[model samples]
Target: MSSNAEIKISGFPEDDGYWFVKWIDEFRLPHLTTSSASVKVVLQKLGSVDFHNLNNLGSTDIRSILGQRKKDADVIIEIRCPVVMPGTLPLVFIGAIYQRGVYVGRLPTRRRTIALADGGQEGFELSLSQQITPPPGWPEGAPYSLLNRFEYSVIPNIMRSSRCLMINRGEDTFIIPRMTIFKTFYAPHTELAKAFCGGPWNDRLDEVICLDDFESGLKTQKITHPEQWNIILQVRVPDVFAPLLACFTLMSSQDRALL
Candidate 1:
């Protein structure tokens, strides 16, 4: 992969997190940016998670790779704080946003940031900013559509292994992840899809911006840890994210069946 292809990550802009969370009309839409069968929607949770190995931890394979664990491959997330879904983590790189092209979610890190070595002890960490929930109606204070439903969790300590961020949460051998979410207004047409882009919470300004035209926040994750915290980012197409999403179809049953 070229330097540019290596995906650039960015944090919420100091000026206004909206820039980091809202939708961008100018960015190029993905060439194949529709929810297709072979697609996957990449989302975030917190800390670093590996996609290829999950069996070690016994976590099930998340159909919605955007927020859950994967089968066979183990995922580990280390952090200082909780992983607030649909708030801290915004609409990142939407693979379905482009048709064969790619949307880049970048993190223009601060100077003097040291890189973590593979399987290194010191993992990654970032601050968990705000947790804004809009009152009843969405932005413009309109009624909320109920076509597509959404829900997410707060991940206390999710990780692959060895590499992780942490906090002394007592002797709770297993860390519980907290989840929150917003279901989309599902209509086959993109016009209906627009409503799902985002809305305001508690009557606050609908300042959350989507990363791209076709991109929207189905869920968000803001994580904190000693050395590193923040959602583990996944870049994928929406269709591919459906199973993980559990909106259209709940994966718990599927997972039980698998087990």
Candidate 2:
């Protein structure tokens, strides 16, 4: 989960330009308030262009003119920004440039999105190879034996991996994701009722960082936000049938016919 990669800047001529952008905030919007985030901004600047010329690039519409200044020979502008990647919330920008404040070419800030520990690429790193412990009564390899086959995988947010399909023998086995989501600045356990515990807000995020270090025999952890919050463990097991016993039943004929 390398969020702060090279402090990048696009749109401006990569060859030459004096773009001075600094992240002074050690723990905030610009500096990442939590350990899970790393802030980086892409400063867009075209040489000597008026505000009207500095369009969003995607839109053909022009901006209204005011007192524009080219005071600095090099355009000594400072944009303290960060690349925000909230946990579980997939990265989506319906519009370009951050539209929070007066987006006078405020520039779109691309956030680094970290998946929920189980439902994301970073989810399996910690949970995989860790070995799934069977129920207290089952033997070490009993779960594997009971089932025809078992496996796990990581599913990216872009992919729609859910509990929709049924797993047929030797078929329909999608990626099994296990996520550990860190919930920082989270409300106290008492305040959250049981119904709210497993809900989306249970891990209502502060920040999220993806790490490939987990399950790789290494301890590189992906962090996402500003606070030292704990993770709510959620397991997305492979779509497999759970073994169960049923005695003499009237639906036997129907079950056989369906099968």
Candidate 3:
């Protein structure tokens, strides 16, 4: 039997701009205050105008305006989640830039912050140039007998990878084998949870299973009739990784559902 928890982010602004988002989750485990998280920002070219034309904003900080961009290219920004005091709440800062007297929507920042608790750790590196690979030190000859044929049929091949998210806390390494959207009843108490915790799924019982809404995103548009699917994650790690896992899950689902 494993523990279950929910991490939610609210009060995000309704305005459209470059978003500086942070999420914090406090755990009851010893020597652990919060989980390390990361943010992935993808800037796609919408029109003929290049991203370089929107420069000359200000200094490079989270509060600063978005910087320049290369012509005919998409920009991807990755920020390591900051560490705050145990009692501090999470925040999402919206930054807008001014170009030619007109306000630009959003931008990126390069400023870094010091962590109060355990300092800030480097974010998990997710490369867009390579495919999703399995975590290191995985058992070579183990069988993936966890998900049944019917379950495998529903999930895409890319989602079945051995690594979804990885978190490093000192000497302890946490790996999220995989995350997917399924019926609400298929997680926690079902065989899915057991399969994720046992056998080839990492063989660790100290796990954190999180069930969250599938429609969670940073966009302003509200879903007219949202689906009832829930994002299920069987993270073979301590409870501190719950919030970070949830954060990556939402981002990956919204940004790269096909990959």
Give the alpha carbon lDDT tens digit for every residue of 1-259 in model 3. Answer: 2321232222222233323322122222222343322221112222213234335434432221123224313434332322222111211122322222123444544543323233423345331122333346746764333222222221122223222334555564443222211112123332333333233433422243343334655321223367332334454444444443343344445454332
Cα displacement (Å) at residue 48, model 2: 13
Find the 10 residues in a row with the least total lDDT in model 2.
241-250
Q: Write down the TM-score of every candidate.
A: 0.17, 0.19, 0.17
Give residue 80's error in model 2 in angstroms.
1.9
Model 2, 1-259: lDDT tens per residue?
1122233332222443323221111112322354343323333332334333444533212111111224323433333233433321122111222222212232223344323333332312321222343445666565331111121111111112221211222322222221112121121121221112323432521112112345545432223565222232222211121111111111255563442
Tens digits of lDDT, candidate 1, 39-116: 112233321232223323232323233233334135442112111122112333221111112232332222333343
lDDT of 1 at 71: 46
Candidate 3: stretches off by over 4 Å = 1-9, 17-205, 208-259
Show where candidate 2 strays beyond 4 Å. 1-35, 44-72, 87-95, 99-259
